[model samples]
Target: MILETSVVPRDSAEPCADRLVLGEHVLGVADGATKKPWDTGPDGAELAEAVAGHLAATAAGCPAREAVDGATALVRGLLGDAGVGSAVSFCVLHLGRREIWRVGEGRVLLDGLPVPPRPSGERIVAEARALVLRRHLADDVPEATLRADDPGRAAVQELLRALVGLRNRPDPRYGYGALDGQDVPDLFVEVVPVPGGVREVVITTDGYPEPAPTLAEAERLLAQRLARDPLMLDPPETKGKRPAANSFDDRAYLRVAL
Candidate 1:
């Protein structure tokens, strides 16, 4: 298996705050969103890379689950008080199989197949803090349950819709409930199998698409590129999100070839 990373910063001088690591059995990336328009910096990505690198170093020496748990804890510790957090997305490729743990809105393309949705309640609450503020309601808060009608699912979908709709319209006096004025990150994890006959896997942040691209399209494109020129699979300057003054968010990605 092989791992490659590519990022497009919001500005020329801003360092890409995206990070990734490729373990013998796992590979992943973390993208930190910058709230300030012209500010380019690293937030949780650094912590994520550190933890992922540690997992990679010990993958063969330990159980994959244990390694992943350890890495997660390490990253959590690193971001404890940095005032920097992230939307976490990770994929582990195990013995001819892959599984993903996803927190936020990142994408995972497996053998060209899209990762299935995993409900995230805490993450929804976190976003509410960022968007709604004093207007955020208790009913709006996400409940920690996996099934539908779950408070978390409802809160997240509503909050996200409001965010997308309100992004283009700025109003300083926005109101939300409980978590009125605070910052929070989107997070998730993804896993992929790297058994023989597998082609490729792609992971990317939400900023790359208006409405996220279909899994089939991503798979077809990646497969075709690999067949025509494998080297292009890991190009020096890969296609990334183009920067704009009013861009919704930053974009980042990781590509694994097997």
Candidate 2:
């Protein structure tokens, strides 16, 4: 049974980089990294759609490895040997194996418990941003002004870009995962078998700081966060508040019943 699913662009002006795919025997969520101005190839939204299409096309009983291999090849084909093919993070469910294959930092919950991954270096950068955000706010900077033009951006953009080099490095300090049509070390891909007792699974993008059990609840939690700390200065600190969007990041949530 399907509970709910949605993918919305941050603002009406831009395309959403997140995607949700439901295949015959599998379904998953894909989140393409936001593109930067220096980015030269197809936008992350297009890449995400391509990857999502590949995921939804997989035949029933296809091995999770083969599915990912195909997606990786597609990404490489699209971006070629570019210096950085910003990739997509995903969480896929293989009904045949009763397994969930997750790459990167997308969130997942079985029953009501979280299936957490190791911390990445994103926090370091998020804190840097929060520091700037708070300082500006203390100086009476309007929240709307911060959203329109992030004064804190220049101070931390370089630090944020540096994290790109750490992708998939397997380093405890900075390594994170993604599917960019390259060889993602096994260390970054997590294949989890759904226990027999587990009856439901929730998969979501990091847009929601804390994923709730239901879509209504998820939206509620997101609204609560946006109202209380739009800057995301608490735990899962992000780059900044919504740049001109409904939420800070594009989001997708999928709940399934076995």
Candidate 3:
């Protein structure tokens, strides 16, 4: 039984980059990345929708890993060179074997504990922001105006790009993986086994601040957190925009049970 499933967008104007697919025996969730406004190609939401749809269409007969590979290939084919190179975090729940396969940042929670530890990129991103912030401070730029619209935004973005590129190499310590419109050799795939008697499992994107036993509780907690720290600036990790911008990333939550 599925207790509850939902995909919520951050704002009305922006497309919801998150997707949820429920097949006869397979369930999936995908979280799309946020692309820059200047990027004219397919956005993260489009990539996520296509990927999730392909996975659901073939999941009944295909193996989980194969389904993901196939979906990636199909999406690449469809986009071709015109692809914007956006990526998504995908999670699939196989009911037949009580197993889950997660790629990128989508999370699997069993009994309220994360199956695999969160990515180390969070700390890296925070550190990178601190470094960028220091550079901007030397230029006498205010922290509030450090978004894409600001004049100094380009320089800041350049610094972030260089730092992130250096850190995003294919290595255990820094290889942050995602389904970015390219072949990734160091894909982070986690296979988790469900507990013997556990009745339900929750898979979600990183939008939720933490895992909760129930989807409602998780949403409530996430909302509270967002209200208190909309920009996530307290610890800030490559998020937040100028005032009047969407405060949170796209969110998806799914609960499947026996």
Could you give candidate 3's per-residue lDDT for residues 50-100 as a string of tens digits?
888876775455665676567667666756742345666788788876778
Against the true structure, what is each candidate's TM-score? 0.48, 0.93, 0.81
Ranking of all predicted structures according to TM-score, beginning with the best and ending with the worst:
2, 3, 1
lDDT of 3: 0.67
Clashing pairs in 3: none
Clashes of each: 32, 1, 0
| Candidate lDDT values, in order | 0.42, 0.79, 0.67
Q: lDDT: which candidate is best?
A: 2
Model 2 lDDT tens row, 28-98: 78998887655667777888899988898888777777877788888888988533757788888877789
For candidate 1, the lDDT comes to 0.42
